[model samples]
Target: MADLSIDFCGIKSPNPFWLASAPPTDKAYNVVRAFEAGWGGVVWKTLGEDPPAVNVSSRYSAHYGKNREVIGFNNIELITDRSLEINLREITQVKKDWPDRAMIVSLMLPCEEAPWAAILPLVEATGADGIELNFGCPHGMPERGMGAAVGQVPEYVQMVTAWCKKHTRLPVIVKLTPNITDVRHPARAALAGGADAVSLINTVNSITHLDLDRMVAYPIVGEASTHGGYCGSAVKPIALNMVAEIARDPMTASLPISGIGGIGNWRDAAEFIALGAGCVQVCTAAMLHGFRIVEEMKDGLSRWMDTQGYADIAAFSRKAVRNTTDWKYLDMNYQVIAHIDQDKCIKCGKCYVACEDTSHQAIARAVDEAGTRRFEVIREECVGCNLCEITCPVDSCITMVPQESGKPYMNWTQDPRNPRAEPAPAAAVVEQAGA
Candidate 1:
């Protein structure tokens, strides 16, 4: 079996799965339960200074699928509503009990250095492994100029990270906000400020749904509502893109990433690791299911790794980063055409409808002698868009088979059709030699 253990920025864990800083890790009870259920670590819910954050009533809403399955979750909830002393005491005892499990405390405070200076020693005294700077909370905390407000600005991210680095010896992991235009800027800022690692993406600002009768948004409070943080399986693509952006950036490439957002299973976790996350953080998954979900996550990841001949997490980590690239670099000469398996076709006409109506009229419909409908792909007209494959209900019924285009590898940048295309390498070399 492949080793699942990871040393994320010097914090060792038996496995790569850690509960994110949310309601799930808000207190000792939840953390202990998660540990007992096989979670390798937990980032205790974000804590503030004395006089804890006041949370609102009806703090959650959900966006559901056709069968009413939760696709996304929204929350207006603030940071830990529990007092500082109680949280600290519980964290101290919990760490003492589960000595092996990673116990990273999440902290949010005013952008001032004094507040950070005062709180660092208290948290470090609790024997927590490290601290995660909660700069990504999008809703309630931002109104106080603490969470996303600070994260949205690169300067503030650097300033507060530097303050924490100055005040504490513990490793600082800056949790980044996804609400920004570009995630790499904040990641670079964290690196510049001396952060050991960075975690993302904090929830996206969203309004899940609205009530038709009352004309109010979801999780309504007295016929009124506001935008909250959106998370869950729906946000995985967004999170993956951000993680890849930071991973591929030259300045922040070496910074460790703790991938968060919409990770619900082993496959999801594996994708994040392949994109260069040192470890992964779970919240909505554990909330919707239970801590026991980690069992399947660990087992599935381990089994898959074994099949791939990977000896450890590092063997496959960041393996996909190099393959991810700009569209301009893609091979325009590479071609593929959809082939429908006659034995497996259900004759649903979904593929034909999808291709003929929205995409290219690549699929042809015919009626046989027996008056049966048949669909076939016109080889010449097919652009290999995969619309037919995507609309097909049956798996493996339509496969896109690559064709030999008989052309050397060429990208858009070197194509003659492009008005601004760069000269071919041979031409450029000849021009340079003549010059």
Candidate 2:
């Protein structure tokens, strides 16, 4: 088996799967169970000054699929409601018991150096491995100017990261907010502040539901609810793009990335690694399933790496990053035309309706001599836009065939009789004279 261990910014773990700062890691008992269940680590919830956080009942709502299985989740839950002293004690105990398992406590407080300076030592005294600045909680804490608000501004991100670096001996991992215009701005700022690593993405704005009978938005109740941060498979693409952008940026390229957002299976983990994430963090999926899910993640990834002939985790990580590029470099002259296999057609009419209403009216409906409605492609009229090919529900019923230049494929663009762009060739005049 390939070795899955990693030393991310001096915090060593058996594997790269760490629970995010959410309900799964809220207490010591939960974390100990997670470690035993094969999770490499847990960010021991979000901690603050001792008054503790107040949470509401029904603090969450879930979106499910056809079988009512959870596909995505939403939360109005706040930070830890336990006393800071209790949290510190739990962190101390958990670290002492499982020294091999990484224990990084996530911290969020007021945006000043004095408050940060005061808290770093207290957290470090627990003998924890590292500290992660919680700059990405989008809903509850943003209104107080600490979560997404702080993350939205690159200056504030720098200021807080610098303060953490100055105050704590532990390596600092800046958790980023996805609510910004560009994720790279704050990521670069974190590196400028001397942060050792960065983790993302905290969640996207979302509306889970609307109450029709009560006429109210969900969770917040009485008053309308604004969008809470969205997490799950749906947000994976967004997170992957942002992670790639940060990883490829010249200013931030060398900085370590802890990829989060929509990571459920080993494939998701592999994608994060390919995009330059050193380790991957998951919350919603792990919580949706159990922590034992990591067992599958570990086994699947190891098997895949072995088959690919990679020696270890680092061998495959960021392998795909080298291939990612911009669109302008793509070959512009390559072209394809759509083809439909009549034998494979189910006559669902999905492609015809989609093409007619939403895209170009390239596909035409006609009555065959047998008095049945039939769909046919007018090769002369078809521009090969591929709307029909994509919308076709049947597999292989529609395909796009590459058209060679000067081929006799009769599309609207190549017709000499049609007057759109290119002028009639002088050879055509000779042909007309000869006629």
Candidate 3:
């Protein structure tokens, strides 16, 4: 069997799957159940100083597909609402009871040094594994001079991270917000501040939709609604790109990553791990399908590892990082054309309509030798854009086949079409005999 255990930023867990700081990890009740369900760890819901924050009613908005599956979820909910002492007492007892499981407390406070200094010792006394600086909540927290408000500023990120590192012995994983223009700046700042690791991406600022009749957005409280933190499967691509950026950056290449956002299964966890995440966190998935989902995550990942001959998580972690590269570095000589399988086609005409109206008229109606009406690819006009494949309702009916082109590798940096490209050797182009 493959070992699912991981030691992330000096915090050891039975597996890499941990619950991100959210309602799922808000209290001891949820945390205890999650642990019982086989979760390796939980980042306790974000803790602030003395008095807890109050939340509003109907603090959720969701984007759904035609099938009514939630494609994206948004939330305006704030952090822990209970008192500080109560949270601390619960955290301390929970950690003591579940000593084998990793317990990292998430914390957010003012920009000054005093509040952070005051909270670090209290959290450390809980016997928790580490602390995660909650710099990414994009909703109500920002208005209070916390959350994304602090994350968007790199200097503050560095300063606050430094303060936590100075005051606490526990390893610090800085949770980052995705609301900023350049994610790398704050990542580098976290590294500069001596952060042990970084977790991302915090929810995005989004308004689900406008209620046409009411002239208000969804998750409306009374007669109004506000933009909340956006998450769920839709944010996976954005989160993956951000994680890859930090992982592949020379400045923060060695920085430990705890991937968060849109992770719903073991495949998602493997993707993050392959892209250089030492561990992965979950929130939306757990919220959508209770904590038991971790069972599949743990089993599926282990089975996948066993099949791939990976003895442990480290065996294949960051395996794909080297392959992720810039668009400028992509080969320009390689070419592919779309091929349609007539036998599997349902005659929906969706692909043909899409190609004829919106795409390059690459697909057309044809009559086969068997007197069957079918859609065929126009090789001469085809651009291999994959738009037809994307529009096709029938899976595997449209495929992109690579053409035989024995041309030498060439990239944008040396392409003749690039006017600003540096002068270099002319690309070797082996043309097809008859086009």
Candidate 4:
């Protein structure tokens, strides 16, 4: 089997799958159970100095998909409500008991160097693997000048990261918020301040639902509600893009990334690693399904890596970064036309209806020799948009076939369609003139 272990900025875990800092890691009981269930590590839920933030009733709201599967989850819950000294004691004991598992502590403190400085040494004494700066909580914590408040400000992100680095010898992973305008700025700021690694993305600011009858929002507390941090499958794309941006950025390219947000399965984890994450963290999936989900994730990822002949996580990590590029760098001359397989086609005219009515009139119905009507593509009018393929119910029944255009390489930056493009060669001009 392929090795699943990773050393993320010197915090080595048995595998790359760690429970993100959330309710799942809120206490030693939960952390020990999660470790017993085979998770490689856990980022103990966000801890702070002195009195902990109190959470209210109905702290969570969720969006459901078809068949009532939870697709997205939002929460107004604050950091651990227990006292700081109790949390530290439990963290220290948990580390002692599960000495092999990675135990990184998550922390959110007032945006002062003093509070951060005070907590770092205390957490380091716990024998934990590392600490993650929780600058990404989108709701309650932000209102208190912490969490997203600090994360949204690049200067604060830099300054606080510096304080943590100054106060602790442990690896510092700055958790970034997705609520910001440009996530890269804060990511760059984390690197500028000597952060050992960066993790993202924290939850997105969102309102999951509203109760129309009551004229109030979901997770309605006393008939009132506030926006909460949103996480789960819905946020995966956003997380992937942000991770890729930082991974590809020249300034932060070498900085280790801990990918978080909407990682539900092995494929999701694989995609994150391919995009340049040194490891991946999960919360919602484990929260919904339980800690046992990590077993499937591990088995599936290991089997896949073995099949691909990868020796370890590093062999394929960041493999896809090279293919990610700006729109201007895309090939404009590449062409593909959709082809429909008559044998596999159930004669469902859904594709024809979609193409002819809503999209390009690229398909038409015609009678075959047996007098049975069949839909055929009008190649001349086809734009190769793939709308027909997407609308087809049968999988692989409609496939995009590459067309031999005999055109040389051209991108948006070099295409004649772009007014700023350089003058075309005489041969190209003659060819266009003949057409």
Q: CA lDDT of each candidate? A: 0.94, 0.85, 0.92, 0.91
C-alpha lDDT (0 to 100) for residue 333 of candidate 2: 51
What is the TM-score (0 to 1) of candidate 3? 0.95
Clashes of 4: 0
Worst lDDT 10-window in candidate 3: 426-435
Off by over 4 Å in 3: 367-372, 423-435
**Top TM-score hit:** 1
lDDT by residue (tens digit), candidate 1, 1-435: 899998999999999999999999998999999999999999999999889988888889999999989999999999999999999999999999999999999999998889999999999999999999999999988889999999999999999999999999999999999999999999999999999999999999999999999999999888689999999999999999999999887798899999998999999999999998999999999999999999999999999999999989999998888777767767788999999998999888999999999999999999899988899999999999988998899999999999997987777788889899986685543333222
Local accuracy of candidate 2 as per-residue lDDT tens digits, 1-435: 789999898999999899998999999888988999999988988998779989776677766787887776788778899999999998999999999998999999988789899989999999999999999888888888888889899999999999999988999999998888899999999999999999989888777887888676676545666567788887889889989888877799899999999999999999999898999999999888888999999999999988998888889887776666454222245577778888888888888898788877778787788977668776766777888987898888998888776633232333445477334454543333222
Off by over 4 Å in 2: 220-226, 336-347, 361-435
Q: lDDT-based ranking, best first?
A: 1, 3, 4, 2
Q: By lDDT, who's the top model here?
A: 1
How far residue 37's Cα lies from its native spot in candidate 1, in Å, is: 0.5
Clashing pairs in 3: none
Residue 313 CA displacement from its true place in model 3, Å:
1.2
Model 1 spans with C-alpha error above 4 angstroms: 424-435
Ranking 2 against 3 by lDDT, winner:
3
